[model samples]
Target: MDHLPPHPGADAAESRVAARADAYAAAPLLGCLLREVARPVTDEPGVHLLPGCGKLLRVRGGRRPAAPEVRTAGGWHRLDHAELVKLVAEELRRHTGLSNHELPAEMADSRDTVAALLTARARATAPADPYLRSEQCLLTGHPHHPAPKARGGGPAATWLPYAPEAHARFPLTLLGVREDAVVEEGDCSALDALGAAPPGYRLLPAHPWQLDLAAAGLAGAFADGRLIRLGTTTCDTWPTAAIRTVYAPERDLFLKFSLDVRITNDIRRLWRHDLRKLIRTDTAVRAAFAALDGPAAWLSDRGYRTADFAFEELAVLVRDGLRGHLVPGATPYLAAGLVEGFDGSPLDGPADPAAWWEAYLGRLVPPVLAAFAGHGVVLEAHLQNCLIACDGDGVPVQALFRDAEGVKLPPGTDRAAGWERLVYCLVVNHLMELAEALAERHPGLDPWPAVRRELARHDLPEIPALLTAPTLPAKTNLLLRWTGADGAAAHYRPLPNPLAGA
Candidate 1:
């Protein structure tokens, strides 16, 4: 809540709000850069030797570090969001010897987007449904990614209307694709029920923003009468934290669209290659969940439909909703939303913190490990990819995982690499963040003991080594972005493992 004194030209309240957002936006970027490109000055408590940027930097707080200051002859000078972006760009330029005008712009756009979202959220009422509120709760997403809120450098007017962070909801743009030009696989009959199509065409739902972006590409299809415009869906779909995916309350189904914007690391488009392999990956995961003993379920990405000529641009993925997959009385909440901190989060109201933590570990950990060890399927069980379904008392009883495109199959993947990813996603990315959130709420209680006990109960061969290991792999998102590495190619650095001695 504390901020440096206001500038002479800036209003006090506005300056404070801007400073708070600047800190929020800069924290993740600074964390990534400092971890990967800078050397820790072990002698100094919060100082780093930033060889890339050619300046020593100091920051307070851990995980999402804040209050960044660069050393100078006069003293340590605090940097605002703009200065921080300049520093980062300079660092990447010096380190890579190449300039990227685009990423720097994206970084600025991300911060500005955060500011706008904060203002909008202040005026708007949060949804009463816990699940919907959770979906709209990600203000500063991907705590370690530099440009988590960046919307491909688009204007606020264009992106804000569809942004989940702003709690925006709109009906899907329905389209009629001629049956002959329609390319589909698996059971996509659920899509047809959304809206009625013409005599010779089938119904296809599209993300409004995506349709706008691909307008140029689809002009020919429309002109040639291969594609026809149908009116919007009668019911509105709620945009999830994953901006491209939407949840239809009336139909109890989820639809994922091929958005062209770059969210997190990659362009948020359903690539043809991933689409081709979707069925195989989803089937494997579905079977694994079915064989598991407990309430853990997999939200299968059942199938997709698209026009043949504009396949990737127009593809829409059909995923199983909460209707059939969820436990009878349990309420499901996105795991990332739990990390992001929402009003009705389970972390907010657990009568017995220790018992609650244990139950959470019990539901979340087993299925991910089982899927990897027994079925040769490595699930991307990160915060956003998984959901924790809790009972009325806010005790977690089940975990539902989604996104077949991110699942990795064994034999095709090296065993060690697969294990590392599973550990990073399930343990480091998912559980560690959740544990931190819990500890923040109840400071005296340590959640790691429960985590250790849960892992010990698992009979996997890797558990012993994991328990004793000094460090766990943490993904280097900033370095990867700076170097222009493929987003899917994960690069990691070691982080101190909390489970090492527990």
Candidate 2:
């Protein structure tokens, strides 16, 4: 593994920060390795036997496991973040008969990125808005993925100013697309209100980071007068957990841009193929939510606008603001943020753990199942894509799901395949993480029973099989990255189902 050199002015405090960053980075990588590649040794708690090299691996803690160690001829030796990466690479190569040169570097980069984020977070003030605070609280993102914090291996300076975990808020660079060169669909009239466009031009807002990354491809357009630079937005926008997407409080708008950076599993560009089908997918989700009888809501992706010449590179998608869909006086918090605790998280200390867990399940589970069974639409109800809104008393009153780009329709994808995708996102990625967090916070609280009961309440045909199934499908993120598979092409392995006997 290529270790990042120590900071030039490193001190005792910086050394402590490095230690914390190592712990933070190692947890997800360890979780991924244990889940996807290692098997538990019978009657040995926290001990796993690697099948490939017959090595015994041990870790401490559950949920976010830490302090990985490997038993060797001499004795048991602990592995630091770099050594852990090396161990993982060796094990994966022996197990899969393949060598991955890139993932190790990403693992190192992720660790270095965490170190930078930790330092920045210490110096920066947290957002006063609870909702914004919740959105920006994901320091250890995607707890099951190996390199969740990897920022395309770029220097920290390039991405730090836009990182949500650092409490970043900045103005967007506005541009003018020549009237005839503008491409748009659906309801994109909201873009016009951001700024004034000169005669024969349309206002186009761009993420400054994306503009910087795509500067080479866009130079010709700037010189040829197809795109002109306008001044930045007067009001600043907050970057959400999804770094490319920003929330503008001044206009009560959410704008998603085509970022060139690879965050978590994918290079998060707004690809043209997905954009062409955006309306169809968003409409299906909207109709499903409209027909459902509950407090569940769908935040619509209204439309997108970009220059025809630079479609994917310059695309900006406009999404619905929170005010319209949220329950009266209810505050919405990112579900992922709730798992990764924030200053004012509702999950931190609920008055009644049972009631809170049930209320959470009641609000979140129904809509996802209903969308799939009742309307043949599979909503990506993962934690990051979901927002749970709480009433004045800290009760979960509503569940709002967004990101239409991740939605799957029936005929395009077979029902069985779509159902599998839904199960992974909704049950595994979303509920399992929340359940673990809730259970960890409140000792002696068995979260599985409530989850099983919630699944039973749903009338969908898949519920019975899901509740009784011995194993639930879990996406193999570590193996996927090691094998250099396409990020969107999900590969799942069977994980023991906790709901089986609950």
Candidate 3:
């Protein structure tokens, strides 16, 4: 090669160093990233007034100045305490924009991880997972056994070779051979089955570092002593659903762009009341609508030394960030996309009147009522909020409660809106979804009885028997499109169930 006057590498390296220096020198950026070496922390005046003392985010300062000192910085800072909070939040938001943008190579995959995440979901009615070892991933696959048989089969019969450090200090399990492939339970497989290698077959759980590439821009712990970029390769645990973008250097997390956020139940009384301000329609009175139509704030409530919510310490490397603890796995948790469900009104059309009732009144009702006494929380028991998830054996074993927002507690017992919203959220809203799902599954089952049983289980104060009820079918018709025969869909079909007493 022709000898250049100077190797470009030297100049490029110098340029990078100078640029970094300039970034630190920038006052606003520097100010936001400043840390308090000795300042006394101060809580918001009214922050302690709120329940759980609305999380106190660490202030970026050498030490929090005294109230008088902070006031002197601007006595108005004291006058507008709420405004200070608002401004800090706004400024903290600006800091999410970092000095540099570097897409990490570790979590990158040619095929999106969403394909494998289909099974990462937690069900309202969870099926018994046989793959999960009783207490540990000890080979022999039993919970307590440390035998090597759990890792017995070779690459053809199984994948994961005997790796001591697989996950949770336990070896990842191989369920069976599928299509000449060693299908590792609760993990990715097809990649290794492509003849990758012998030991390569050992499955790797989601690595925590992936968050640096995945989060909007590592928020927490970035502005402190060291700018630690925390991210989650959210796509790594997902095997289903579509991902629009990981959007590195742009957004922190990957979202199913098409999802509707309104489904999440918001509990703020102000937001709740403001919804029905203009309309008298029942549509204006619903709970799911509030969650779906929200510009909901996604924040980490847990506090840490990090300027922002110390997501680095709290966000699981592999677990779904929001309401993710519901799923169990190693510390290298599986990732579930913080996605919104597509909204088209899951309850808009009824499949079969008799089936709907059979599912609603028969199979689904009895157990849901029992959920209240069993769980200490009367779940919203609404449509779309309950999964009715089944196990490998196709039996309902658990009810995955989606929104704690709509849960019920007897009046004077503690909980806003007490029982009014509770009844609606639980029996009316949540159960409707269960009823619709049940009817779709079994057409012959009577939904009315289950409704009665579910109500009975809850000790309902009143029954629709004497009152002019909204024609049982019409009650559900408003939600579903399926109408039973005779142009009048209010009919009965009993759902099949062997276990009633239980």
Candidate closest to the true structure, highest lDDT: 2
What would the C-alpha RMSD of candidate 1 be, to one decimal place?
Answer: 3.9
User: How many backbone clashes does every candidate have?
Assistant: 0, 0, 62
**Which wins on lDDT, candidate 1 or candidate 2?**
2
Query: Where does model 3 exceed 4 Å of error?
Result: 1-226, 230-235, 239-376, 391-398, 402-417, 433-446, 462-502
Give one digit per residue, the lDDT tens place, for model 3 in 1-502: 8776877687875555443322222211112222201122344431211111222322222211122112333333331222333333333334333221111110111001111111121111211222111111111111110110111112211211112112122111111111222222211232233122223222222222223223355342234322322222222221111111111111122111111111111111212222212122222212322332212111111111111232222111111123332223211111010011121212223444454343324333444434433333344444423333222323332333332223343442343333333445444434433443454445555454555544554454433331223422112211111111221222221222212321
lDDT of 1 by residue, 235-346 (tens): 9998999999999988999999999999989999999999998999999999998889998999999999998999999999999989798899999999999988898898
Model-by-model lDDT, in order?
A: 0.90, 0.93, 0.25
Candidate 2 stretches greater than 4 Å from native: 1-10
Winner of 2 and 3 under lDDT: 2
lDDT per residue for candidate 2 within 338-412, as digits (tens), equals: 999999899987899999999999999988988898889988889899999999888999999999999999789
Measured on C-alpha atoms, candidate 2 has an lDDT of: 0.93
What is the lDDT, from 0 to 100, of the residue 1 in candidate 1? 80
